[model samples]
Target: MAILKHIANKSADYGKVLDYMLFQHDDFTKKELLDDKGRKMLREEYYIDGMNCEAMLFDEECEMVNEQYHKNKRYDEIKSHHYILSFDPNDKEDHALTGEKAQALGLEFARNNFPGHQALVCTHTDGHNGSGNVHVHIVINSVRKLDVEKQDFMERECDSRAGFKHHLTNNYLRHLQQSVMDICQRENLYQVNLLSPAADKISEKEYWVNRQGQDKLNELNKQIEADGLTPSKTVFQTQKQSLREAIAEIASTATSLTDFQSGLLENYNISLIHKRGRYSYHLPDCEKNISERALGAHYGKDYLLQQFDKNTKGLEKENTQPEEPQKPISSSFPNEPDVSTIFNPSYDYGKDPIAILFVQTNLQLVVDLQNCVKAQQSEAYAQKVKISNLQQMAKTIAYVQEHEYGSQENLLESFEEVSAKLTDARKTLKETETSLRDINQQIHYTGQYLANKKVYIQMVKSKNKGKFRNEHSSEIALYEAAQKFLKAKNPDRQFPSIKDLKAEKEKLTIKRSAQKDTYNYFRDYQKELRTVCSNVDSILGISRIRQQEQEKSQDIS
Candidate 1:
């Protein structure tokens, strides 16, 4: 039984997965291998650029052969006939007998059923052992050289349709299985299995391995013996040994088990518990449990306990062992590319989560500034309306004085009344101007804040390389950068520049000790400003209405 499995993904991360599938030695490869990412290397191997198509085979070597076949044939030659066959081994005498039967059956199937199709069969071993389950790769050319020039139209059409080359397809697989089944029945080799009726597919290697049973255990024991250690009689033999060594070392040091456990737990952040029967060392929260079955033989209890003893005498051992000159740090992580510059999308032209959050906050600040500008403009408009009314009143008073000039008494009375009115208007105008100046200054400050905020957002975005979204939020440096922007924009503004704004921002920063707190500060400040403005709208509304009423009265007169 030769088991088959198919897997595929659109991403180019196939190289790492392929290496795992092909080369991993169970625990070693599975544990040591790094995360798989990036584009598949297969495309590069085949030099396929933009060739978005499906591939059938699993092995890379097979892929090379398939590539050659397609390159040589191209589309010029077509397959005229197609045939598939299989053989079983129940009645066959031996491995040689079965192999002969399969080859003969395949050849015969092609000749009888497929008129012009030729057989291209290949055999592969299961790779675990010498169980021979044979399979074939078939390719047939479609184009045929005919002797006669003229032929019946119906027959020519049939030949042309049948001449299309057979590519890999499910139909082809089905055809192969059926062909094998037919041959198996004919040859009386009932043990040959087809994939359908899907008879629990198993690879010949796995089949042989299962049959070989405890021999695999023997191999494991041999590995232990080779490693200069005796085979453990029981599963926890290694753990027990390590425990005994640990206890012996503690006794030598005259140290309590509690002290040792505390030290180990502190360093490793894993639990050390003493049960009634045995002592168990728990794995860290982030780590998966390494099964005793997998590790007990190689990493015996005694070995681990001795390791702890070594750790306890680390300083003494170092004193005895001459200290070599310190080797310079290479600055390169194992298996990592020399990526000096982190792909910080937040800092780059791209938008990361942190950059996005920063931009959004800054944009909000701009919006608040714009609203403040509109508020100032509105107050300015009110001042203009009041001034226009005062000017109109002055004109009327001037006209009255001119008409009463002949009567000294009437003119004097009118002069006094007009003077009072003019004085009041002047006072009102001055106050309005003062208020307008204050509002203008506030608007100016808001504008400055907005500009600084924008720069901060851009700086943060650039720093992150547009990958800010994936970074740890608590570690994000957006806030510090923003604070720098604010300082450069407004040198005089201190820790709490805008009294109300600073208070709100400080609330968010209280818990955060770093730059993260500062960014959060800006977010809270913007939100508070919006709330304050919404509440102040009532006062703004009253001033607007009073100004509008005066204007309407004047318009009516």
Candidate 2:
């Protein structure tokens, strides 16, 4: 079981495919915090900034909220006002019932373990892998209502952001986690204390072995396949080559019956046999010889006839089947191995997939934010610098117009040069000021993008539900893979070198590029709009003043 939190501006619009992916179910509870109908959850609202709106809640956490409401009467009493808070219980294996239990546990812990003046709970389910590993979401109102605001170490940021008099502490979450563990202990639930050193050691060893073995096996198979063929070789080459070249050179090409047998025996330690009447040959010990599935690679009567037909028709093509395995990789490994002499009984394990996923997603969002902020800041700074230069030019032009002197014959020349310079300098300063204003608008839009990106990653992670790692080493590997697959210019054949593996990082460089570009364009558009609006205002003001003066002159006459 994993616990994750999301603070989204609009909960309904955040995640698109989360409810379906989590296999969440609909329920009509006494207190209906969430309803799962057609891939959407309607949120419960509380008083926030003196307005009634669907409270900002974490995704997939309806049931947990119900359970919490039952345990703590305080939650129900405080949630009378309108504010949005969301919670998601990430479960990926049919564990909604367990999620309910955990939710109950969370409520009891919050009520008895920690004291808060006002609180509310909302829970939803995250469907990962189409399995139900139920998660619980708890949203507590930061306001203490009538209680005295305590300015102490426990005060959290939500207090300031949401405009609450009193602050909330994360100790409430800690206590909830502890309470859930206690319930697990009492109810005999499968408890993997990932934080425990002993458990950590075992997990690391097992995960390493599994990953390394898979990699080595894939590498070996690829090597063998590559070695059997030349770079220029194709399916048609089987017909135009020498018999020996076809059989020995192209591993996929079968020549005489003896050649096939000899190649299999020498390379894979596999032997073939044919019955007295049967045309097809069978590998007697296929399980030991081939890494692929026995049935798929095994030559049957139909395959033999197919190949014969191809030969008779004067067409040549080799078998182009992918490799299979004897058993699933995950099923092949043992849970606990005998390592009494070699390993320690106590070693700390890294965080689980759920925790690691949140951390990575959140961290990536932060990185994107930093990049965005830097770009915006740079553009804004550049605009400021431009404005400064333009202002200097404008001042110089104005000074020249007022102070520079020339003879009556040369006055025309001085006026032409100085007046033109003044007009150009004024225009430059106006454009610079406009650019700066546009940059400011863009910064505001960028902030919105960053906020939305947080919601997007939260939803994406909830859908994945697994494949996250916590170890410094494992985290490095995970991020490197992401970089290769998502960010690399050519990922198919481009693998990061061993030396650079540790240094390589996954980033949303291209992804952020598009977002930043949009923001920047919008910003520029806004700046241009502002300048045009200002020009219009100035023209309107001038026209109004002239009209007023004409009326005054008529009245005076």
* Candidate 1 TM-score, C-alpha based: 0.22
- Top candidate by TM-score: 1
Report the CA-based lDDT of candidate 1 relative to the real structure: 0.38
TM-scores, one per candidate = 0.22, 0.21
lDDT of 1 by residue, 1-557 (tens): 22222222223222333343233222312332333773322211111100011222223332333344442244333222222222223233322334444545545554433343232332222222223344332223332212223222213433423223334356545554555566655443444355534312233344444444445667887899999986643122233333333334333432345566665555334455555534555665435433322323323344445555666687577679986664343445322222221122232332221222322222111122222322344454344334443333333333323232323233344345444544554454445434443333443455455545654555466766456534533333444554555566559866334565545445434433343344354545344334323322221234356569999999999
lDDT per residue for candidate 2 within 1-557, as digits (tens), equals 33323332222222222222233333212122344463434432211111011333322232233244342234333321221111223222222244355556445544443244333433343333223344443344323322233333344544332223332236544444455566655533445442322311223234455445555666666676788932221122111122222223223344455655676555434445555544322334333322122222224334444554555444333344555443222323332111121112233323221122111110000012122322343454344334443343333322222322222223234334434544554454445434443333333333443444444454456644353223233444444444444334334745334333222211223333454544444344334323322322232234356669999999999
Q: Give me the displacement of residue 130 in model 1, in angstroms.
A: 2.7
Minimal lDDT window, size 10, model 1 = 43-52
Which portions of model 1 miss their true places by more than 4 Å? 1-90, 94-100, 112-115, 121-129, 132-163, 192-221, 227-557
Worst 10 residues of 2 by lDDT: 357-366
